[model samples]
Every structure is written in C-alpha cells, then in structure tokens.
Target chain A: MPAVHAEGLFKVFGRRPADAVRRLQDGASVADVRESGATPAVIDAGFSVEPGEIFVVMGLSGSGKSTLLRMLNGLLETTAGTVRVGDAELTALDAPALRRLRQERMSMVFQHFALFPHRSVLDNAAYALEVRGVDRATRRAKAREALALVGLDQWADQKPGQLSGGMKQRVGLARALAADTDLLLMDEAFSALDPLIRREMQDQLLELQASLGKTIVFITHDLNEAMRLGDRIAIMRDGRIVQIGTPDQILETPADDYVRQFLADVDRGRVFTAGHVMVPAPALVAPTAAPAQVLQTMRDTRAGSVLVGDGDGRVVGVATEDVVRTAVAAGASSLAGLPLLPAVDVRATTPLNDLLAAAAQDEVPVTVVDDDGRLAGVVPRGAVLAALGGVPRPAAQPPVALAEAEAVPPADETALITSGGIRG
Target chain B: MAESSDDSGLLPRIPVGEWVDTAFDWVTENFEPVLDAISTASGAGVDGLTDALLLPPAILLAALLALLGGVLRSVRFGIASLVGLLLLISMEMWEPAMQTLALILVATVIAVAIGIPVGIAAAKSSRVSAVVRPVLDFMQTMPALVYLIPAVTFFGIGVVSGVVMTIIFALPPGVRLTELGIRQVDGELVEAGHAFGSPPGKILRGVQLPLALPTIMAGVNQVIMLALSMAVIAGFVGAGGLGGLVVTSLSRLDLGLGVEAGLAVVILAIYLDRLTSAFGQQRRGFPSFLSRGGTVTTTAAASSRSVDAPVTGATDQNARPEPAR
Candidate 1:
C-alpha cells in the first residue's frame, strides 16, 4: 500500500457544507458555490505517495495545495472523501486515535518555524516526543541525536529567541525528525528564510532525504524548489490539480496553458533531465552484423552514428558512418573490429545543464543509459542546443538528425531559444 | 400638558431597593455558617501576615526588603526600598503600616486565586467570556464603597470584612487582564501545540499560560495597587490599620498626626507599586536597570515617575491619619 492515499477529498468552508459539496459534484463553479454561501477550498483532489518518495504539491497561494496537504495528515478534515495513511483510514479514526497517528506516524514542519520562544532548543526539539509520552531521558537522547543531525546540538541549551532564522528553522526540522515518524508534512517550510539561507536549507533537506528516505509531502509556491526536491510534483490551481508528473515531464510537456504559464519562469536547463530531451538513436547495430548492413542501416535512418548493443540491449559501443564505411572497404565481415569513436555515456536522469556540458566536448551524440546500463537513447548536441534555445523539434520526427539540426546559425538559435518558443 | 402631566399616569416604579434588602437579609440568615467560615479563614490569613510583618525587627525587615528589591530588580531599587521602609519606621507608624500591607497581601492572594481560573475559562469559551465581561464591568464600576455595605452586612465589622471588600474591588483587573492575555497569545503557537498532539490541558499549561505570564503579571500588579488604594476605605468599617489612624485623626482635626500617617501610607504604596511593576517588566525580559551618572534608573524608577505625581499630591492634601482608638 502507498504511504498516504487520499481519494476524492473535498473541503468546503462554510455552513451547509453538504449542500456546497452537492453543488460542486454537479459541476457548479467555485464562484457559483460561493454565491450560495459556501466556498470550496479543495475539490475532488486525490493523490497517493509511495513509501519513501518526496511528493510536492505546488501552486500559487489560495490554490488549495496547502489544504490538500493538511487533508493528507488529517489536520484539516475532509468534507467528503477518505484519507488512508498506510492501511489506516485517517478520517475514520477517533480523536485519540488520530492524535496517536500524528504522534507516531507523521509530523509537520511549519513555514514560520512555530517553536516556543520560552523553551530551550533541546526542549522544543523534544516536544513531539514529550507529547507522545516518551520517557524524559529517552526523549532527550533522541532529540539530541536529531539536533546533531541538523548541526544544532551545540545550541541545545539556548532559547529559540537566541537563534538566527536559519537556526530556528533547523530546530523546527529537528523537532519533526525527532518524532521518528514515517511521514513528514512540510508546509512552505523554507519560504520564510533569506534566499541564501533558503538555498542552504533546501540543500540540507535534500541531504537528509538522501540518507533518511522518509515519505515527505512538501508544499510550496516555489516551482524551483518543487523541482529540486520533488520526485513527483502535483501542480494545483483553484482547488483542482492541473498536472502531476516528474519535474522533467512537467517542463517538457506541461498539461495545459495554466501549467505552461506557471512554469514560464522555471530554469529549464536545471529542471529538464536528459531523458526529457534525449532522442532515440537513429539505429542500433549488433556486434556480429556485417559492416555493409551497418552502413545501410545508418543511411536509411539518416543517422551520423549507430549504437552497438548486445542482444539484451546493453550498449557495448558506438559505430559511426566513417568507421562503418572503412570497415566495408577493408572487407571486415563483422562491425566489431572497427575503430569506433569514444562517446560519453550519461544516465537518463542527468539534467540538461550537465548534458550540455558533456555534449560540448563530444562530436557525436551522447549516449543515454537506463539504471541497468541498457541503452535508453541519445542526446545530440543539436537536441541540447534546441532544448536550451526553447526550439520545438518537428512533431513528425521526434528525434532530429544532429547534422541537419546543427545547420541553424548560432545567432538564430540564440534568438529563437531566448524568445521562449519551446512552448509551441 | 397632558403628555407631560403626572406621576399618577406613569408606570409604577419597581421596588428594586426593597428586593435587594430582602435578598441580603435572606442570604445572611441562611448562609451564616458559610459566611462565618469565610470570615474566619480571611481573618486568620490577615492576622498571621500582620503578625509576621510586625514581629520582625525594623532593621531586619528593611534589610530583607532591600535584598528582595536588589534580587528581583536592581541595587538602586533595593536602596530605595531601604529608604522607604526607614521612613515608615521613623514616622512611628510601623505597626499600622504592616497591618495595611498585610490586608493588601491577603486580598491580592485571594483575588488571584479566584481570578486566573475564571480568566482562563473566559478565554477558552466565547459564551463564558460574554458572561464574564459584564460581571467584571459591574464589579469595576460599582463604587468601592458599595462593596463595603454588602461585605459588612455579611461578615459584620472586622478585618475580615475589610479584606473581603478589598478583594471585590481589586478582583476585576486580575480577571480581565488574564482573559486578555490568554486570548492574545499567538494563534500559531497554540496551533503548533495542537499539531503536536498535546491535549488541551497540556497546551494551556505548557504553551498558553507561559506565554501569557508577563501580561498576567501586569494584571497582578494592577490588583495590588487597587487593593492598596482600597485599604483606606476598608477602615471605614472598623478594620484597624493606617486607614483607621487617618479616620481617628480626621475626626479630631489633628493635622500633624494625620499628615504623618498619610506620609507613611504614601511611602508604602510607592514601595509595593515599584516592586510589582519592576517584576512585570523583568518578566518581559527588558533590562530592568541602568547605571548612569551616579543615578540608576531601575524599572521601578521609571514606573514611579509615571505614578508619583497625582498620588503624592492627593495624599499631601488629604493627609487623614487614623488613630488607634
């Protein structure tokens, strides 16, 4: 089962919630519902999180992303629908049971770092555990461990008022960490910090996530942060989810004009992965294939190079046209003996910025490999340039030949890309 | 002329005064044991504190006051307290001053004990707050002398009645401020407590109360000041203290004795007022003292400057000293 599963969740804010929900289900607009004295904050919102993935809910303020996040943890009750954390239905739990769930199964970090000003850093960090009725010594020890994890053990005795904003936020993170729950709900947790501090905190959270792998439901208005931290992001608008996908998928193919507009300012070079821009190789040749056949296949596919893969699709090497032609003249029976050009291989997950850096040094298309070292596709220099320039490749031919695509002048490429034409 | 005409054409006046008179009589008759029990408890508390204050050697009490002043605030406040106590001693009104202090202390303790829980309840529920607000307003606005009539009617003439009346006069600020303070605690902090799964009671104790403390202490300070101001009025009902001396001296038109006793009262008021206000300031984490050019402006010094003007003028003029008669 997923760590968190929310289905058909609707939250209506006002009296006569049932009436409002009926109107919403009957396809009434949010404004229409409001006219009748009810406001729908979240409508039919649903999503599930895997056990250890960072699932981010992204939107502008008042978009119901926060409301959705709160519903997942039962902080805000759902007017209609069910939320299950692990196998337990949150909406079905009684107050005591729900509190126990919050105490033992999930914890939240707030935007303002809601720490008690009167409490010592150590005590504030240990608060959740204290609420859970953990014994004092054990709670303190655990809190100390969490504080050390966040690099704040030295400030344990100091009051929260004595800490800087970054340090106070760390205490908030430590409090959630100390609870040792399986799920973490972070509501715009880093938005209050200065930009530099915010970046540092994001980096710290990423590092912690790497080591801990806790299921996190992160809410933010920042698309950059959502892209950096989310394994999958759900983009919300006006109480409805417009799109949910990996950062690269969202950047490459936004679900609608709203999502596209929402992503207009995103730095695609950092967000789009090699997998997003990589085209399938023009051709794949076997090691035992005749050189004549290899050359024929490359010409038929209008390709500069072909990847040599084993029967199971593992990439052994690249075979260029020049090598194939030389092999054919040399009377080589198999293409394996040809002096193939060296090529850079990168994982499909490599960002376009890194792909551009790798592609800059290589003449041939860079090979993209899956997690298991199987050939996935190739990212040509043209594809990188086109993607970075925001130029849309032809729809009929998904993978453009590098030589043909490179014919565009660098100045036109710069103008076309800088004009943000990729949306087309 | 017809419209303006007569009392005979108007509605009959409700006999509210007679109803109140009968109600008080009925309560006094039936709840005599309960009333007596309250009087005994209040009397014991007042007498015990009065004896304790008066039994200590004059120098020892002054030293202790100075020490308390220094520890809670600053050495300047300590020295000021020392001078004030010495002035009381020099006026030969030490015992009467102690009795007045005792009455204020007893009334304040009782007021706080009853006030805070009521305040918390008022803060927690809108209905309770709505009910409590009008009651508090009535308690505060009713003439301080009105409390004496009912207090004496129930407990008869004694220190108990005086203390009871002082408590009624002083209780409103304690309750009102406590409610305001608790209500004013940041909503986010309370939400954080709830989000962490702390029970409501724990949230109140651990989160709400601690944050509200400085404001509540300010309320306690107000209560003490109001009680001190009522001490003189309490003496009208035969409660013996500096107020009694002022009353006796005023009847005889003995200006010298009355002036001395009134000066003693002013000194005591300033001392207690300075101490309690400094405590409130200290709780808020402001640096309570500053040393400058051989004059230390302690927290109390700042407050004393603000309060001294009207009080000193009024006391200097009225200067009614009660006698031991």
Candidate 2:
C-alpha cells in the first residue's frame, strides 16, 4: 500500500469553502472562484506516495505545494477530499487521534530550523519525544543518538542561539530523526542555507535516505533540487499539478507547453542518460562468423560498423568495415582471430554528458552495456548531439543523424565534448 | 408653548453621579465578604512585613538594604541607600517609612497576581481585549483621590484601605504591559510551538511566558511606582505612614518635619526604581559578571558618573556667577 494517499484534496482559504469547492468542481477558474468570495489555495490535488520513495512537490511560490503538503499531515484541514496515511484516514480522525498519528508516524523538518531559542540543542531535539510523554532518560538518550547521527553530538548541551545556521538546521533534522517516524515531510528544509551548505545538506539527506529508506514527501521551489532528490516529481502550477514523472521522463517528453517552457533552460545532456537516448544495436555478429558474413551484415545494417559478441551475447568488440576488408584480403576464413576496432563501453545508466568525449573521439557509436557486460544498446554520436540540442528523435529511425549534427563547427567540437557533466 | 420651548432649550442633565453612588452602594451591600476577605488578607500581610522591617535593629535594616541594593543595582546605590536610611533613622521616621514600604509591597503583589491572568485572557481573545481596554482606561484615568472614597466606604480607613486604593490605582499598567508583552511575542515562534503539537496551555506556559517575562517585569516596575505614589495619597483616609507624618507636619505648619519626611519618600522611590530596572536588565544577560572590570567599584563608579554628568554644568555656572559677584 502507498504510505500516503491524497485524493481530490482541496484547501480554500477564505470563507465559504464549500461553495468555492463546488465551483472548482464545476470547472470554474481559481480567479473566478476567488471572486465569488473565497480564495482557493489548493485545488483538487491528488497523488499517492509509494512506500520508501521520495516524492517531491515542485512549484513556484504560492502555487500551493506547501499547502498541499500541510494538508497531508493534517496541519491544514482539507475542504473537499480524503487523505489516508497507511491504513488510517486523516480527515476522519479526531484532534487527539490526529496528534497521536503525527507523534507516532510522521515528522517534519522546517525551512527555518524552528529550534526553540530558550532550549539547549539536546532539549530541542528531544521535544517531540517529550510531547509524546516519553521518560526523560530515554528521550535524552535517543536525542543524543539522533544528534550523533547528524554529527552534532558535541554541541548537544549548547543553546540553539550559539550554533551556526548549518548546525541549527542539523539540529532540526536531528529532532525529526529522534522522533523515528515512518514518514518524513521536509518543506524546503535546506532552502534557507547557503548554496555550498545546501549542497552538503542534500548529499547528507541522500545518504540518510539510502540507509533509512523512510518515505519522504519533500517540497521544493527549485526544479534542480527536485530533479536531483526526487524519485518522482509532481510539478504544480496555479494550484494544480501539471505533470508527474521521473526526471528523465519529464526531460525527454514534457507533458505540456508549460512543462516544455519550464525545462527549456535545463541542461538536458546532464539529465538525459545513455539508456534514455541510446538506440538498439543495428546488428550483432558472433566471433565465429566469416569475414564476408560480417562485412555483409555491416552493409545490410548501416555500413559503418557491427558489434561482435561472444556466444553468450556479451559484446566482445566492434568490427569496422575496414577491419573486415583487411581480414578478407588476408584470406582469413573466420573473423574469430581478426582484430577489431576499440569501442568505448559504458553502463546504460551513464549520463549522456559523460559519454560526449568518447563519442566524439570514435566514429563508431559508444556501446551501452548492462551489468553482465551484455550489449544493451548503442548511443550514436548523432543521438547524443540531438539529445543535447533538445531535438526530438523520430521513433522509427532512431539511428538517423540530424542535419544539425554535421553543421557543428569543427572548432567547437572539442569544447562541447569536454563540457562538465552533471554532479551527482 | 413656553414649557416646550424651555424643555427644548435646556440641556438634559445626566445622573452619572447618582448612578455611580448607587453602584458603589450596591457593591458595598452585596460583596461585603469579598471586601472583608481582601481587607483581612492585606492587613495580615502588611502587619507581618511591617514588623519584619521595624523589629530589626536600625543598623541591621540599613545593612540589609545596602546588600540588596548592591546585589540588584550598583554598589554606589547600596552606599547611598545606607546613608539615606541612616538619615531617616536620625529624623525618627524610620518606622513610618517601613510601614509605607510594607503597604507598597503588599499592593504590588496583589496587583500582579490578578493582572497577569486577565492580561493573558485579553491576549488570547479579541473580545476580551475589547472589554478590557476601556476598563483599564477608566482605572488609569480616574482621580487617585476618587478611589479613597470607595476604599473608605468598603474597607474603612486603615492600612487595608491604603493598600486597596494603591492596588486600584496601580493595576492598569500591570494589565496593559502583560497583554502587550504576550501579544508581541514572535508569531513564528508561537507557530513553531503549535507545529510541535503542544497544547495551548503548554505553549503559553513554556514558550510565551518565558519570552514575555522581560516586558512583564517592566510592568511590575510600573506597578510598584504607581502604588508607592498612591500610598502617600491614602494618608487622607487615616492610613498612617510617612504620608501621615507629612500631613501632621503640614497641619502644624512645621516645614522642617514635612521636608524631612518628603525627602525620605523620594529616596525610597529612587531606590526601588533603580532596583526594578536593574532586575529587568539582568533578564537579557546584561552587566555580565564574567567581563573584565565588572567589579563592584567599577560598576558603582560608572553609575555615579551617569547620574552626576548632567549636574556638572549647573555647578560650574553657579561657581562662575559666585566668582563674578
């Protein structure tokens, strides 16, 4: 079951919420509904978070991503629909029950860190447990453990006012970790930090997630952060979700003009991967094949080169037509002992920018291999250039080179080939 | 036609005086137990504190005052308190001054105990604030002399009446400052408390109250000052203290005695004001004892310099005029 399921959720901020919701259901614009005496902050939003997945809600300010997140935690009441966390329906729970659910199953980290100024760092971290009526010794021990997890144990006894901003945010993270809830809600938790610190925090959070695997609902206005951290990102605009997809899917096939414009400035080479842009190998020749057969296969396919695979279908090397011609002129019967040209082999998961140099240096397409070293597909130079240029490739003729690929000035090829790839 | 013209021309008189008299009469008749209970409690408190102050030897009381002043304010204030109290003793008014001090202390305690909860209620609800605002305005603006009549009618002329009148006159600042303090607590901090799942009461006690304490202490200082001023006025209702001494000296046309008693009150007021203000400042970690040169002598010198700087020009001008003459 999904860890959190929000269906048809609505949050209208002003008076006459029911009327606003009804008008929204009847397809009235948010501005029109607001004109009739209510402001719709979140309109008919619905999404389900799979267990142990990081689901990100991405939008500009006032697009209701935070409002939608607050509704999932029952911090804000939903006007029109239901939210289920695990087996319990949040909207149906009483105040105490809802508080108990929050205390037991969910924790949130805020953008401002929200450390109580009067409390010591240890006390701030232990607050959620204290609210749950846990004993002092146990809660303090747990809080110390959590502080240690965030690498802040030495500063436990100091007041929050004494800590730097990054340390304070770590204390906030420690507070949530000490609660040890199944679901974590982080609302722009790193947005207030400096850029260098924010990057460090992102790496720390990814490491924590790898080990903890807690289902997290992260809210961010930064699309780059969403792309880097989210397993699935839901893009919101004007109080409605416009698209939800993996980063590669969203980059390759945007849902609408809004998404298209949204992604226009994105560095597609870094986001797109070898698997996303690779074409299936034209033909595969076994090592035992005759040189004539290999040459004929290369001609039948595209006349550039053919991949030579072992009997188990793992790629051994590439056989170029020149090498085949050389072998046939020397009266070689079988191509098994004939030399093959060097080919650049990369994992299918390797990002496209990482293959730019190898693709530029070799005329043969870069080989994409799976875990077992079997040939999965080939990323042609034209496909890489097309993907980087943000041009859509035709479905049937995946290996066809774009005319723009040949138009590239020779002076810029080396610069383009060695451009910095995306940072993990 | 003439009668109608007269009625139209004459402005109708409001029976505000009669209404007020009747309201007081009704309260006096029905709430006698409440008044009696307050009188009895205040009488015991004043009598106990008065005995505690007066029964101590003159030297002991002076030393105690000096110690308190040194601890709360500066050592200069402490030495000044020692000299002031010795002067009061020499004038044979120490007992009356201590009685006055007792009256002010009891009144301040009662005022704060009642004021803070009302202020918290007002901070929590706009309706309560609306109701409280005008009532506080009325309490503050009414003549201090006007309260004596009601006090005399309710608890009759004594220390009880004096303390009651002082509480009434001093209560408004306590309420207003407490409400303002709570209202001014950072809204984001309050929201943080709420998001942590704390109930309203716990949030008020743990978060709001601690943050609001410095402002509330300011209110307490105001209450003490106002109560001291009113206690002197309560002398008209036969509440005997330094004010009664001044009143007697005035009746006898003895300017020397009146001047001495009045000077004693001024000394007490300055001492209390400095002490309370110092207490408020300490809440924010001021006057750090850990800092270098934070000894008693340095603090005393600093404080005296601040107080004496303004008088230097006047003294210099006076000296020049005398030399010219």
List the lowest-lDDT window of 10 residues for candidate 1 chain B: B316-325
Tens digit per residue, CA lDDT, model 1, A43-68: 99888999999999999999998888
DockQ of each: 0.59, 0.36
Over A356-412, each residue of candidate 2 has an lDDT whose tens digit, in order, gives 888886446587776777666667677778788888876854531322222223212
Stretches > 4 Å off in candidate 2: A252-255, A265-270, A281-367, A371-375, A397-424, B1-11, B72-93, B245-259, B281-287, B290-325
Candidate 1: tens digits of C-alpha lDDT, residues B213-290:
867776787778778878888888888898898888889999998998888888777677667766765653335444
Per model, how much of the real contact set is kept?
A: 0.59, 0.24
Name model 1 segments beyond 4 Å from true. Answer: A252-255, A281-345, A360-364, A369-376, A385-424, B1-12, B281-325
Where is the poorest 10-residue window by lDDT in model 1 chain A?
A415-424
Best by TM-score: 1
